[model samples]
Structures are given as structure tokens and as C-alpha cells.
Target: MTRSAAIVLLLLSGCTLQRPVPSEPDATPMRIVSMNPCVDTILMEIADSKQIAAISHYSQDPRASSVPLKWAMQYPVVSGAAEDVIAASPDLVIAGPHVSIQTIAALKRLGIPLMQVSVPETVDESKKQISDIAARIGHRQTGANLNAKIDTAIAAAQSGAPPVSALIWQGSGLVPGKGTLADELMTRTGFRNLSSMLGLKKWDILPIEGLLSQPPAVLLAGQANMGAGNADSNRMLSHPVLRNIGARIKIAHYPSSLLHCGGPIIIKSVARLAEIRRLMEAKP
Candidate 1:
């Protein structure tokens, strides 16, 4: 072939090589790590089976998560340490606001994209937090649906109830006060939380004697303290002073995950309390 023709062919080959090759878009996180139980539940609810890499150990507890134990068993559980998280090398990581600040800082330094979730102290705040997490994970629709469910449950719970007072017992004689999720749940479930009237904030350790003397008509106990064979519940139930309260007393169990950390599960917690309230009202 002529030299000119050969040069033209070479140029044609070079041009063809320079043309861009069409490629598929990147996948949306095939591996995810959740450092908090709240985030773990949210992720598991929406993430594809192949996408979840690991979750916090707390997700294994049925009381703490909606995920079944069998499902939780399929994934590795991280204890919220930098080493464990780094080893997972997940495409996404979720951490709670209460998670160790130092661990978060370390993960950030390592250039991991960490999503921070806040613990809601009120029902309104819980809704906002759930929405934020859902939006972050591209599940805004799911969040909206869940929010509607929560609203309906709360409304039903509040219907047809007289002015009833309630106290929430966390543990070790601690009661949650005003501006807290516990208070909000109690209020939404058709009862007034006496803690707010007394102007308490956060969880306060109350004297057992004082509580017995002026106990509310209904008492809500934390799930941790109400679990079967719980010594704390046994002691409280067996207390002589507690048994003598004139007002009707009922033990309502609050999910520790919802009350302790605050998340989407709070809606379920409200529903549970509402059921308890219905049962209490039925007693003649």
C-alpha cells in the first residue's frame, strides 16, 4: 500500500480509539454498614438483601428492632468501633448522634461518608428525624407512609379518654420528664404526663416513697425493666406501698429502642401504649 494510504489508516484507527465507550452508571451502594440500631432498622427495611454488609449488634434483639433474628443473623454486627467499621469498607455508614464522638471523628478522618441521626425527644422531633433519615437514604416515600401511620395511631389512641395522668419509669426509679419522647407518647396516647406539670426535664431519679405517695393513675415502664424475670419489675410490683395506690394502676411497656434512642419505632411504641390504655379503660 502507498505510504499516504497507510498514514490515513493509522489516523482512522487512532480516532476510533479516542471515541468514548458507553458504560453503565455506578450502582447505589452494594455494601452498607449501620452503627446504630435506629439506622440499622431503617436500612434493613429498605436496603436490598445484597446491599447490607453489617449492622450494630443491638439489631439482633427483637425488642430493639423490627428485623427478625434470622435476618439479623445473616449480617455481621459492628460494635461501633473505627476498626470494625473500617474493616467493613462499606459504601455507606450510618451513626447516631449519641454514638461515640471520637469514633465518628475517626471515621470522618478516614474519609468515610457517615450519616448522623438524632435521637428525638418529642413526637414531632421523632417524625422529623425519621423523615430526615429516609430522605438521606432515598426512601422519602417510605418515610411519608410511616409518618401517616404514626399520625393515625396517635389519633386513635387519643380518642375517647378522660383526663388521665401517667408517669414513665425508665429504670432505677428514673422517670422521664417534660419535653421528652416518653412524655410526648403518653400525651398522644390520651393521658397527661404528670412530669410536665411538675416541671421536670430529662430523666430524674425519684424517691420510691415519694412516687408511691402520689403515683399517677397509670405507670409506663421501660421495656428493659419489664422483660420477663426482670428483678426490677418484681420488686416494684411486690412493693407494699405501690400495691395500695387507690387509683387504677397499669404497667405499660415502652420499647427501649424507641424511648431510649428515638426513631421510627416510636410510632409502634405509641400504638402499644394505646393498646394498654384501651385495656385499662375496659377494667370495671
Candidate 2:
């Protein structure tokens, strides 16, 4: 072959030997499995319904999730079982930091991609987590909007009277102290958590009798009618020792789901608590 023909052949050979261009990383997850209630709420909010392969059954309960039961009923659920999750063939799995270690390990062993979210302990942390999740799902704008709403609600709530001494009743006379999201929420709503005043951290189990002796200015109960039939609330209100306390006691029924979950619904919880605080201020 002549020089030009040889050069042409070399070029053709090089072209034929070139590797194909790598495909772009898949930005859209085709199948998503949510193992935690909070994760389920976030995924539902940010991702299309068709992108989700399965969710936890707890998402079906209105009490446990902000999503309507009807909406939850429309989707299949894995209930966080390893076998069930594997069967769903999810491209991604979402769970909370508190999920069972064993389950996490099992999923890892199967080479499943897992995203673990932490529960927020403060308003700042809550905002950060929301932004993080939103970015992960390509919903950063939605997250920013939700954060703004939360800040606005908290500011509105705090604009009123000086902080009142308050107690957050979790259950069985257990109250969330300092270093808890409940405590942070109470503070954001213009209440000085008595637990924080006492320098306590986490949920402290106090005898109902002790609370009666030194009642707070306001009693904030999680979940309306939570302890109504139980001995806790009844004991707090009906206890003869508490009858003479001058402070106004009110039951703020913030659903555990809203309070416990670190998602967009936290703004709703803050708004509800603000309403309760206003009611308390109006009372004689």
C-alpha cells in the first residue's frame, strides 16, 4: 500500500479499537425502598410515586405519617424485612439511623445502596437534615422553601409573651429534657423547658408525685388524649396535691409522629404548639 493508504488504514484501525463512551451515571432511581417512617415521608414528598417500589406499612397510618392513608394504600410495602426488600429489587433503600443494626448489615451484604438519616435534635439540625435529604433526591428548592416556612412559623410563635416554664410529657410521666428535639421545639415556641432548667438531658422519668409538688407553668402533653385513660395525666390533674398549684396546666396534643419525625412536618408541629400557647395566654 502507498503511504496515504497506509495512514488511512492506521486511522481506521485506531477508530475501530476505541472504547465506547461510558454511559452517564443514573440520576433517577427506578426502584426505591423506604424502611423508616421518616424516610418514607421524605421520599414520598420529593420523589415521584412511580419511582418508589416499596414503603413501610407504618406510612399508611395517619397518626404515624403526614401522607394520607389513601395515598399510602396505593403503594406496595416491604415492612423492612430483608427478604421482602430484596424481592422488591430496589435501586436504593432509605432508613433512619435508629434502624436495627442487623437489618442494615443484611442489606449491606446484599450490595444494596442505603441512605441513613438521623433524627434531628435541634431546629438547626432539622434544617440541615432537610437540606441534605432534599439534595440527595434533587429537591433542594423544595427543602429551602420548607425551611423558610419553618423559620417563619417559629418567629411568629416566639413574637408573643415571655417564655413560660413548661414540661413536655412524653409518656408514663417521662419528660424530654435538654438536648432533645422536644425540648428544642418547646423553646422555639416560647416555653422555657423545666427539664432544661433542672439541667437534665434526655427523657427523665420523674414520679408523678414529684411533678405535682412543683408543677410547671404549663404542661405540654404529646398526642391529645394520650394519657387521658392512663394514670399519668389523670394523676397530674386529679392528684390532690396538684389541685392547689397556681400555674395553668394545658395538654398540647402534638402527635408523636410529627414530633418524633425530623421531616417537613416539624413546621406543622411548631405551628400547632404556637396555637396552644396562644390559647393558654387567653385563659383566665
Which candidate should be chosen as best, given lDDT against the real structure?
2
Off by over 4 Å in 2: 1-26, 222-248
What lDDT is reached at residue 127 by model 2? 85
lDDT of 2 by residue, 190-256 (tens): 7888885555558787666666656677776644243434322323444554445544455555445
Q: lDDT at 149 for candidate 1? A: 76
Off by over 4 Å in 1: 1-27, 61-67, 222-234, 244-248, 253-258
- The pairs that clash in candidate 1 are 121-181
TM-score, every prediction? 0.78, 0.78
lDDT at position 190, candidate 2: 79
Q: Which 10 residues in a row give candidate 1 its minimum summed lDDT?
A: 16-25
lDDT per model vs. reference: 0.67, 0.68
